[model samples]
Target chain A: MNRKLRDLGERRLVEWIVRRLEECEGASLPPGDDAADMLFRGRLLVSCDMLAASTDIPPGMDLRDAGFKAITSATSDIAAKGGKPIAYLVSLMLPPELGLESFEDLWEGFEEAAKLYGGRIVGGDLNSGREIVVDVICIGEAGRTASRLGARPGDILAVTGEFGSQAAGLHALLAGRLEDPEARRVVERFSRPMARVREALELAKTSAVTASIDSSDGLAESLYQLSELNDVGFLIDDPPISAEAERYAEKFGVSLFDLVFYGGEEYELVLTLRSKLVEKAVKAVEGVGGRLIPIGRVIEEKLIKVRWADGWRMLERRGYQHF
Target chain B: MNRKLRDLGERRLVEWIVRRLEECEGASLPPGDDAADMLFRGRLLVSCDMLAASTDIPPGMDLRDAGFKAITSATSDIAAKGGKPIAYLVSLMLPPELGLESFEDLWEGFEEAAKLYGGRIVGGDLNSGREIVVDVICIGEAGRTASRLGARPGDILAVTGEFGSQAAGLHALLAGRLEDPEARRVVERFSRPMARVREALELAKTSAVTASIDSSDGLAESLYQLSELNDVGFLIDDPPISAEAERYAEKFGVSLFDLVFYGGEEYELVLTLRSKLVEKAVKAVEGVGGRLIPIGRVIEEKLIKVRWADGWRMLERRGYQHF
Candidate 1:
């Protein structure tokens, strides 16, 4: 007979979860207390993100990927602030029919992500709901944090890794191309997006970096946010499209520009920095085994412009919107 | 024309929310950053809770009460730890059809609760979903924290305020008895439950208190949790049922004992303290304009017993379970 969540009861389930968690760094009090206690060395950074099954999960995704995506998405925000993640508190709204095995798998994936990012699952809340909803609240620390409002007109605009992969992945998934290798890779990119913590931490150590944001809302949306926050604009000469994404876009007959500019959940770091320290920033990211790809420069025009081989065109300020 | 969430767009909605938020206390970095930053003077206490519309909200309850309940429920955990609330992060999963006015009202209620508890809404995540789901993560500070595992054999068991009110309220709501004064009071109690932060902080100042927990899962369930954690049992002589709850129970033809023992979401603090310092604990609670009602004593035995005027009976370990 298969055991269900109802068989174990809420308290028993919580006890089982508590037993499975290893002691995480910076945690003074763990799961058994009314609240987890932590000691932070400096300024505490906190970010929260919620993933709903109906809105966040696409086709060909399971609970484990949902769990992983939830944490990384929140951690990406912390990374954008150039903060080192210390602890996470996850609140799960699970349906009653959810199996005990599935719950364990979800938790395993959640714990795996926390360990990979050097953060611990310090506490959480579980409640019955109509669908699976995972809300992750991440806590971190930073000595000096980067802000979106710190970008200047003459700053260089850069991004880590490449874009359009997640968008391509979503397109493939929606098109039911699950077995294709390129589709699988892009789907994996969408499902298991990694936070740019290492690169952001390295960049934060230098005085070169000004404004930073994680590209959870696509490159164009992120640039628009940076522009709005700092009252500036961007002039893009190059758009970094990953080779795999390029292939997937071509195979799926999707526009490369649309994929790169409007694809959300990339989890790449988009940053602005002083032009003089470009080499230093590049070297710092390289030290972390990541490349800082400069795509554009902050401009005083207050309108985004992108240059192509044929001509220059003004890009519409559009991206994913939840509502 | 009425504005729907979809009409305003996520970015515009967020901008509206940011504009509405006043500068919160202890927030080094506020809403616009990747993560809100805070400086803690002592050990940071953290707790998270999620409320779903399908399960948590009752009949006739609006969005404002839902938001208030979400924060206060989480605040109860911090209070159980005898921590002073500093900041709160709320992640809301809202349906697209939800109006802008309703969203604003929900946020107003959330902010109201935070301010009332001496905390503030520093940051949050908003996403589209099928239903309204509020996940609240609270961060607080404590110099000397209370734990559920601290109860000792022979300690006196006490609770702040009465029980069964929330249960009575739920019953009345379900029965459609919203017009009665007693029902109204209980419904109000259930709708706007206050966390016992002030009383817990006062009790923490003295060395009298040992174990502490919030009565979120009804009296029996909370006691069972305390018993399991401390490796002890409780012998109860008095069950604190409020007069309003008693009247509501009688009016509804429900057992008073059942209502008191099985009703959840009370947000009352259940605590165990040294026998000699019961008076001191009571005085401390009184100093904070609250009352500490002694109900039982801890025993070395592993079974819980309840004494009535007629006879003594063993209390079954049963309460509300989400599954």
Candidate 2:
């Protein structure tokens, strides 16, 4: 118990999986969250997101926060396309000498988060580790999946929350520059980044959104993804950065724009819509208390170029990769 | 490169995940697996399992085996209800210093198992570890789930494959009795278990399977589960043990019957059928090279008692709980 998860091996970690599920989340026949038995009326469209240790997690975090963030990663994917997440399942592979209750409590935390966002923890896998890897699969219903490909010329770009707070906080935490109350905010955001499932659901219900993506991989990368999916170019403007990020950048001499443009792990929803419905789209999310801020517009050109207060150039490699 | 995965923390480790999942699988919308999207149908089933290093995984195993085993733990739930697995996702939080490529290679193995079983993985999360944990979620589809609540007193009990091999092989490996070729089969069963999704699918084509439960939580425990659901009793006969298990039990001075009866994680299909179509049911699984051995029948009594060659007694501690 004295050792961290990094000191463990694969077989030694994932040995705690019980053979049978303990309970169900709903009255429906199928299980919920990670343990699911969904009845689909049509052809199924599914996807999985696997998060490894280093790139996605903040260091020295609690198991509960890690569990929350883990669900957030998968839920973010579900939120981007206007899907209502039905349930979530998780596979937690822990190191051999791990305290058993740590995982049991963590599983409960994961379940709470799923319920908080209107999803259930249905089922999951537990295995030992080369490293601690948590893989989440979220299932949702779709009349039509809002994709990044729907954006076209003149479509406006928007996000659900302020950018760069998590990024700047992450930078400050790593750089040892975070101080006092600001440190708590930055640390909290860094540790428990939330998914925008409710926001996406609201957008989908209104049918005003054209394209969408989450901010886990940063702004420019998501814009590029939208451009690729829709076969249209983008001219994203200066994104709205958090006041905390501005202050932290000033204190640490970090670039505020870089955090706004290319920082990762925000878990916010980035979407596109026609300018005509921009007000409606903004109102739809606001009624649900979900923020929607205009960032820029889709362009006719085939390249994604950003415009700041200064000048602009073609953007490249805004975030991370898993391969 | 030869280092193991347990030493890595969250940040360095998640970077490893970002590298592995650049391409989306079975995406329903654009920017697939990057954030939340539409649910593919009307509902989803969900669950989570925690893999313990000391209890779930055996020592001296390949990293890829962890990935393979993780899939089995999740998919077995789907198989229990005759659900077709559609997609899977994962979340990984690792200890500091875990090798990233080890994750890549393991993912390749996990992806291969899913493909072999006719499922795909789409998204996941990677973070740093205080302990290494791998959590997987599998999504499945069924017309009408063969629930545990449907069994009657006249139903016949059946199973798909021989049991006890994984327990015996794991015991041998842990106790240092493994040798080439002879030890390989047992070890393979332990390291690379398969879910009975195909058999479950075939079972779903008919209503003959009145109630079903996989023997993952040991045959005894699964029987109790069905009894609880149907509010009836189970009269299970002697379950089949593998030839390898028989040999290992003799060498290790343990009871082969005990292992087959009480051991879990066989990943085999089990169901309760009406006695009227027992012949047709046997033919059904046999037609697909999946054997349906009648181990017992459901009873009207409320107690779940099993019979051996000699006598019958009340069962104790029906299944294995990894905690």
Candidate 3:
């Protein structure tokens, strides 16, 4: 633990990671091979996600959470495509001064997330940089996928899970308020987000979802993206706001609407399905130990509107921007 | 061109990149989709390679060269595995102060490398970081590969191309002696290295090669690795030293042996084949417009030796260490 990465060197660091990798099923090449080999006979889904310490890791978050979040974010893309993740390639850019313990924590987080998502951490690249950067490439497979351009007017708009918790959690962490249970829950949501891979995979089996998008960007921004791509609008009567987030917002006088709509990193799926097949979709999610929360309905008006206490309010087209 | 990434924002930057992507073959989903989709029916090879600005891009090299090298390095892994690359997913961590023109150059280099390697740049992720970092994930297909652990005694050791040019080139570039033609040639080798993908692919078809490894980590180091893995030794009677490198070494009073064995980033392939099947392997490589240079033979004893001018000399197991 006292040794830094510079002392361990890149080759030994790779050896350490190889020692921790669980035997990857169906992997023809061993863990330390130059490349990971997997035989498949279907559609292949590929996505890459990057997270850096400067912008991604908040003050309260650690390297382990950063690594987990990086994998989760990449898996969320696969889930949104209705694909099951099979393997991952992680490329890390680490500062020379990073300690071996921190590096181990990061790898542990990667292992934990891969176990949770049923994928193998097959192979990756490592280099030296000014700060820690984790880039995860997810390889998945699926028979069919729900695309953002497939939405139709009169479809039910739903989410895989509640929102606003991540936003509220970020706020609570920033304010250093973890004494309250609700605040702690929200903070945990913000720190260690989970991908909706199981729910999306099960829902896809029903073939009821017309369109899908990952809500890593704010929920409102995801709605706007789907609207633009499908040339449709949404009328959201019930936003899937979290109960813990609600209590925290009420106690802190925070805007619940903003928290639910504008907060990002939710890792949920904002999707649409035929209103008639709602029962089937709900049953599929429930079968997988998940729940589908209906938030609104797709419309042809080309505008997003939310039913608030006073009247319908227009949702802006904005989300988290990297730069 | 004058605008910085911070001013352009992440959304517009992504849009610009999407606009620049070529028409990807067999891509079920469009360019801007969250994940790239492809259909295949064989063994899949996955590898990732990362290059950072501080570590990878030398003083004279630009972002475009860095991007190209990043892709080339990753493709080399696939080549060593005897795989044909199908698609690439690039993830970039850029500094906010980077210029738009530089970013364009980087993308252009990626496009150029993809074209040269006969693959599509399907999808990628972008994020802000402390410096420029390009992590490319190569998804490829292969029928079979030559493993490093397959070498046997009396196997003829060979290389796909000459060496020492890259090391000499780097020295020339660092010494600011590009005015000389030989120096410039060596420098070009250092700056723009090509992967032995075609040669390795063709050689893999012969079914005569026993072991293979990409020699990017220097020729001597590659031999040492193959030796250790196969529990064998090599008697290197001949070193494939480039003429230009030899000239540069003489002119600069540098050791030719060191230049040939210790200089890294050659991007060549070191392999071992049965002496009787050498003709078949040579024919296959030549058919693909590449040459196979015979170096020596694998020995039963587990030691690496080079036939130096004075006598046989033991080669150290050392190469580039990132830290």
Candidate 4:
């Protein structure tokens, strides 16, 4: 735990990985943001992820969550790419201290998560090492990939489901806020994130959407990616926060807007859509059992401005601090 | 460091990786073995390995040798499979303490090594981590892979180049025996190991080899593997030992047999050949500039024995220890 993991952070590490893997004959994008490209085979998608326990996943809440979170984590990227999860790989790094029970629970969670989504857990690794580093690389095919750069200046900004609940809920739970049974919802939000694969696919097929990104890191970070890629500004009106978030925000003494903007692990999607077909886009997303809430619109200026009744202000941090 | 990698040792980590990387349409042997299978455009063979400082490469070796050795380390497996390298992916995980000079030196060594081995350093990843782990993932094509299980009872044991040089050379360098410049040969053997790709390929083209495994893990381990795979026996009259091996034996007070039979990182091909193709095989490999040394013969029984002055004896502990 004392080891600082000196040198390149995740961003730089990812950049390096992209560069190397992309050189392979089938590597999708050399190295950059989001997910790597898969040479589409079946309409289904598969994604992979590796998490070093010391560096990636924190100390336990539930072991099964490892499996569930792994699946959901991969599925979230699939959702961002406007693809459906057909299957996933789960290479679990088991430390020597672990037991058979943990492995069984991990597999169980994997099965549960897959059934929750539409995919199944296929084959993966069971490697041992100094640290617990779980790598899950997935395969995904897109009907149409929703790139972050696809947003136009006038595109309508949107989000799937509510924001900030997980952040507030996590904070409250950490602060011994177990008095509220609904705190389980927030914990579950973090533990069992649902990838909006169907919604992403449906939206991608429509003419209404422009750009999309998964809100794994948080709303601000996802939006920053969209703006940076598209070279556009966002005039966002803070979207409606969840009830759990408002209560948890008060209990944790953290700002509701902060939770909405900077809180991460939401696994929801923040998307930009064509202004003229905003209604159509919403309908398309909702048609697939996903809620699309219009949060803002793209502006000509090269800034992500938060516009409220009081005044217009600049966001201090545009995205999630993944590193 | 004391931990067995599979018992949360390297094997466990590898299995964890396998689980996470679970089979997509493209990924092969996910996170298992030396390298994972990649679905590149061609019938490509790719493997990535990370060399650690203390564990893999001893401290203070030349950057060029490190680079050369890295390439050799990977190419050896391909050679065993009777494959020709097309290209390499080099990921040099540097400690932050290292600077531009070290990087340049490493790059120079890497480029030169790649060039010498007929592979291009197409791309790489540079990141800071705990140890200096240089991962080299090589991609090659097979005319016919000299798999581990192809040998039969009558197959003759063969090798390329002299053995025991690397271990003895390393010992001399570590003991400051540089005054004996002959030790340089062994040192060079370790630092600048060349793959037996040429020999493997030539053998494959002639269809002379029954089974093959790189002698990197030494003749004893290879014999054990080949015998196990073919359900045969191995009887070596006098396995090849490097020049100065006897001197090293005297200096270190170790049995010369131990260094030659069980020592590793040789990177020479321990190919199994039919008794009939001895001359043709020798000519075939020598024509490709790979000198073939026929060492022993296979037997009907399943015992793997080495001949000594007294009689034949079975080896106890098998081969090289990467840990």
TM-scores of the candidates in the order shown: 0.97, 0.76, 0.97, 0.68
lDDT of each: 0.86, 0.67, 0.86, 0.63
DockQ of 2: 0.29
lDDT string, candidate 4, B42-71, tens digits: 333444444555555665468768877878
- Judged by DockQ cut-offs, the docking class of candidate 1 is medium
* Chain B TM-score in each of the candidates: 0.96, 0.88, 0.96, 0.82
Error of 2 at A285 (Å): 4.2
Q: Encode model 2's per-residue lDDT on B1-323: one tens digit a residue.
A: 56555545333454455454433344554323454333345434444455644456567776688778777777877777667666666655545455657666667767777787776665555545455466666666566676766788888988888888877767667776667554666777877877887777777776689887777767777777677667888777665668888877776688776777787777776678988888887787777778778888888998866665589867765455432
The superposed Cα distance between candidate 4 and the true structure at residue B242, in angstroms, equals 3.3
Q: Give the per-residue lDDT digits (tens) of candidate 1, residues B137-219.
A: 99898878888878889999999998888999889888888888989998888889999999989998888888899998888
The CAPRI quality class of candidate 3 comes to medium
The docking quality of candidate 3, as DockQ, is 0.78
| TM (B chain), model 4 | 0.82
* Candidate 3 backbone collisions, by pair: B169-B186
Using lDDT as the measure, name the better of candidate 2 and candidate 4. Answer: 2
Candidate 1 ranges beyond 4 A from true positions: A24-28, B24-30
Candidate 2: count the clashes.
144
lDDT of each residue in A44-139, candidate 4, tens digit only: 333444444443354545668867776777678767767666545444434445554665566677778777877644333232335544444344
Ordered from best to worst lDDT, the candidate numbers read: 3, 1, 2, 4
